[model samples]
Target: MTWYRRYGRWSLLLSWAPFVGDPLTIVAGTLREPLWSFVAIVAVAKVARYLAVAGATLNLI
Candidate 1:
């Protein structure tokens, strides 16, 4: 909780990352981060991650 209080918003930028992403989201819920803000940020992060992956795959192909 202390870590989240300090780094929560910054960390949300990486909420698209695997492994750590799920825990970060759970902690966000436990800490009661605002629903709209959480969804907006996480949605952006996830979309960015997928776009990056798609770009990389296309480049490799």
Candidate 2:
């Protein structure tokens, strides 16, 4: 089975991760995931990651 067949939409959550993010985005395109959903999911994941990093930094300071 293909990556899409295995992971499906859940894989989009990893699109904001480092190293793997770019490739995951490419996979999403190759799989023809809907633009709106892709943008929305990726945006949310990225924002959450940013917030977590910011929070950790502030706590360390």
Against the reference, the lDDT scores of all candidates come to: 0.87, 0.84
Task: Give the per-residue lDDT of model 1 (tens digit) for 1-61.
Answer: 7888988766787799889999899888888889999999999999989998998989952
User: In model 2, which residue pairs have backbone atoms overlapping below 3 Å?
Assistant: none
Error (Å) of candidate 2 at residue 46 is: 0.3
- Candidate 1, poorest ten consecutive residues by summed lDDT: 8-17
Q: RMSD per prediction, one decimal?
A: 1.9, 2.1
Q: Per-residue error at 40 for model 1, in Å?
A: 0.7
Residue 47 shift from truth in candidate 1, angstroms: 0.6
Error of 2 at 55 (Å): 0.2
Q: Write the residue-wise lDDT of candidate 2 on 5-34 in tens digits.
A: 698767879877889988888888888888
Q: In candidate 2, where is summed lDDT lowest over 10 consecutive residues?
A: 1-10
Off by over 4 Å in 1: none
Candidate number achieving the greatest lDDT relative to the actual structure: 1
